[model samples]
Target chain A: MAVVCFMVTMGLYFAATISFLAYLLRRSEALSKVSLGITAAGFVAHTVALVARMVGSSAAAPPSVHEALSFFSWMLILVFLAVEFRHRIHVLGSFIVPLALVSLISAAALPDTVPTLQPMFRTLWLHVTLSMLGTVGFAVAFVAGVMYLIQDRLLKSKRFNVLYSKLPALDFLDDLNQQSIILGFPLLTLGIITGAISAEFAKGAYVSWNPEQTWALVTWLFYFVVLLGRLTVGWRAKRAAYLTVIGFAGVILTLIGVVLKSYGTVS
Target chain B: MHVIVVGLSHKTAPVEIREKLAVPGSRMGEALTRLTSYSGVKEGVLLSTCNRVEVYSVVDDIEQGYGRIQEFLADTHLSLSSEQLTPHLYWHADDRAITHLFRVAASLDSMIVGESQILGQLKDAFESALSHKTTGLIMNKVVKKAISVAKRVRTETKIAEMAVSVSYAAVELAKKIFSDLGQRTVLLVGAGEMAKLAAQHLIAQGVGQVRITTRTPQHAVDLAEKFGGTAVPFEQYKDDMASADIVLVSTGASHYLISADDVQRAVTVRMNRPMFLIDISVPRNIDPAVRHVDNAFLFDIDDLKQRVEKNRAERLQEADKAEQLVVEEVGVLREWMKSLEVTPTIVALKQRADEIKRSELDKTLGRLAHLPAQDRELIEGLAASIVNKMIHGTMVTLKSEVNSSNGAAFVESARRFFSLEAAPPQDTRGESAVDSSSCLAHDMNAPLVEQVPSRTASRKQP
Candidate 1:
């Protein structure tokens, strides 16, 4: 049942991506609304699949790359839909939905060899979820940042092309980028604290030089600077946008490393 | 007879010439009456707008009508003579005139295509003519048709949706910076006209408060009062920048009024809140280096113009589609006008038949002068019956075609197929034929029908 739901969701995401890309060219409001409807439908199917996978596994095995990646993308779409509902910026769909699709496709392409859940990993589930959710927030910021820089350059260079016309205004994108980090940073701090507690329980130490732990700390510290700078110095626009992009990259690389390490152990 | 338009538009005339020639709304009735008073002009409507001043008229002769319109223009303006105005005026006749009017109504020929203002102005011009009673049947149908064409263009295409002016472009850019202008504060640095217009547009969009500041404090207070806004002392204007979301700097100062350091300080004071600065003056009042400020977005005149140009290009592309709609509507009007000519054509045809039958009967009766009067009457009756029978099928076919979709094709072919046009305008043969055939007296003015067309044409009421 879970596999069927995943397949259905995969197909919907693919359809939504194509619909959104076509809408970008037409710039018709109806088409964008319809495209958004399709994405919402896909999000429903994806959520069902996520619940089914988690309940079915019952925390018996370490999560497979497919499940982890699927969960990450699910969180990403959740954040995206929230932003989309609030902003009503149709152009963001063209930039953001493709990220979810790539992650889902990557999950589907993986071999079904990695264990689905970890022993005692059930206790750390909340920690893992929060961290992934934090990454979702950063992912949103990345898209917003990329859009902000592109829109800024387009404005400055005075090349008001089709792409430039559709993107949200630079200041709005900057605001979104800052807001995403502001929301995500605290969740990550909580995630790090919970992770430290789990490490203490499993390894009898609060700090383990595990690759995942080390990278998470480094990413948390980087975003810490971003949030601090944002609050005190009013770090925003170009600098905030660039930092969000770099910070999200750190989140992504850390995830890739964790996934590879798990696969290396299995092989 | 033809529909002719003679006027100066933005493309043909400078603003100075257009302003001199434009008729004020208060005197539109007088201008229209004076326009139709000319010998060649049958009916007239004067469209006067900031960008163009045009006279749309139905006339007896396009060439004579164009000249008379120039005279009317010279007479109305008084400051500009026919010789001076002639170089700036453009004239279009017949089908081209209708097409031009349609394009104008659609706003395809506007300085900025798809602007929407021209359509309303055209409607007003038509209404003014309507109230003045200067418009006839042709002008009424044509002007109303032009209005409907504009409505169709607006509905069928996305032409008018693009905001293409420099002022509108500024609004678009502001939307990019701020989510809504309704609650944002606008600070006008100087009393520049374009800046005032832009700030006024923002206020119309519901911008909360306006603060006007200039080097001349009295001028600032007076201009500020005009906007119902507060006037700031020039030295204290920078303090207002902290609360102001938008800053419009359009001073003629040789040096930068707001430096990069000033922008940085304002952004810092506002706790890094975003500020949108629009510098519309030639010598930029806002510092160029302000672009480096983190929370400050500055756009000068050139940047705004580039956006306007891009939007204009898109509007022009959409206008290509609007032009096709106008052309399609013109073809429809052309067909309707052709149907109008059917009555005159039928009259001319019967008149020709009478001219032939009467002259031939005269020749035959002279030869049979020795015969009895009763026999002569029978021969004349026979000729009349034959002539009626020959024209019966043609009259029925031509009359039925007036409502058909391809009625124009039939009208053209019928005119060429028959010798209706064979009789010249001064055909004296028509008068003698009229004298003999009293029953066909109404139709006997065949040569006159060539000049005075349709029932309404001779009456002059329409």
Candidate 2:
């Protein structure tokens, strides 16, 4: 049932992505509406499947890394849908659905192995959930940043392409990017703090110089600089967007480092 | 309905002409009343703005409406002749007018594309007309739909998101240098309209202070009072220029208002802190070479206009999305209209046929009273089947022909051929006869007489 639900959700995500692209090309409102509807339905189905798996499992918490990742991706979709509902930002779906699809596919392809829940690893769940949520928030910010940069470039270069035409304006995108960063940065800070605490609890150390931890700290520092630049130097929209993209790169590096380290340890 | 638009805009008319043609706020009610009273006009709305004055109206006779409007303008203004104004007047008919109104309401046709002022202007015009009851059903529907389309374009597409205006562009540029304008100070030179507009925008962005300087102290004082700022002496303008973060100069002076030397002095005094200077004057108030100064940015009218033009082009491109939306909506509306046209005729035809069946069944039953009950029921079923087969082809023809251009004529012909007028007007209060008949066909086991018209003469005698 879990596998079937994952497949169905992946299919829905693919359909939603195609429909969104169709809306971009053909500029059809009906297609846009249908795309949003399908994505919402997929989120619901994926949620039900996750709950079913949780109930069937004998584990006290999430069974494995793969299951945790799948749940995290589902949470991202739920958050995205809620935002879209409140803001009525149909264009964001163009960015979000593809990311959701990638995450879903990755979750499904990962090996299904039940890991023993060590007391320390149990504490790490909070760290993982917080970091994942923060990363998702940053992903949304990155999308907004990319849109701002493209719009800025178009305005500067005086070439208005179809994609440029479809995007929100530079100021609105700038505000959206700033808001996303403001919301995500705190969550990320908490994630790092909790991870440090969890590492101390598990290994009797307050801080570890692991590459994942180091990169996470570096990512946090990047956002800190962005906030300072925004406050002191009054960093303009384009510069801020560039900084967001760089920060997102740090996030990606941290995720990869953590995954590779986990794999190495298990082997 | 024929549509005609006659007026001048910023492109075709000078400020003098535009101002003269502008309908003052006090005169709007009277203007709307007079416009609707003109001959051949079915409905009318007048859009009067500082940049443009246009009258949008539907009429039975386009030429007559156009002439009357021209004459009305001549009579109101008293000095301008119809011939003199005719060159500036533009006329669009039918689809062209509809497309023009939609584009204008969407701000795609504005001097600055995607400028939101036009939407408000259109709403004001609609409301004014509504107050006077000058707008008819056609204009009401068209204008309401146009407003919805404008909103959809703004929300669904990215047309209205950016700074397409020069004043707004200046503020956006300021944001690029300083993320937050709340701590910055803005200085206005010469109290020009453009400068005032830029000052208003800066204030809205949370600029901490505003100072206005003009060659005429009273003018500067007036502008300062309006924007809740302070007026400074014109001679002290150079001294204050160093203290200000952003300076906007739009004066009518032929000579440069802020020379390169003036900026160099200010830059040195301010310790090379970044300063933005915008010169919107026609002849260029600030020296273009000042842009060469280290950390001192000077943008002339041309540069700002170029950016605005780029934004306008981008907005136009985005308009394709809005256009696609409009096309789809229009298609749906046209389909609904066609369906409404066909329904009434189908109902009338079905009622007439049902009445004929009931009368014939009654006469046959009277003659067959001596037959057994089961055999009578069998004969009645056969009669009903024959009636259904006979009407099937006619029904098909009616449904097919009802939505054609000559649909009304076809319906008229069918009504006459069937003598449907004598059928006691079958329950026009209920659903259409076609729908009722389909429901009847689906439930064939039910009594057929319930679906048929009762005898009209028996009801009249009672």
Give each candidate's interface RMSD in Å: 2.2, 7.5
- Against the hidden true structure, what lDDT does model 1 obtain? 0.76
| Candidate 1 chain B, poorest ten consecutive residues by summed lDDT | B432-441
What residue runs in model 1 are displaced by over 4 Å at the alpha carbon? A112-118, B1-164, B287-295, B310-462
* Top DockQ hit: 1
- TM-score of every prediction relative to native: 0.58, 0.47
Q: How accurate is candidate 2 locally (lDDT)?
A: 0.69
lDDT of 1 by residue, B40-139 (tens): 6878999886568899998867889888988898998898878899999899998999999999988788755665657656756776787777786667
Clashes of 1: 7
Among the numbered candidates, top TM-score falls to 1
Model 1, residue B114: distance off in Å is: 15
lDDT of 1 by residue, A104-172 (tens): 998898765564324444556667777777877888889999988888777666676777778887767
For model 1 the TM-score comes to: 0.58
> Considering every candidate listed, which one attains the maximal lDDT?
1
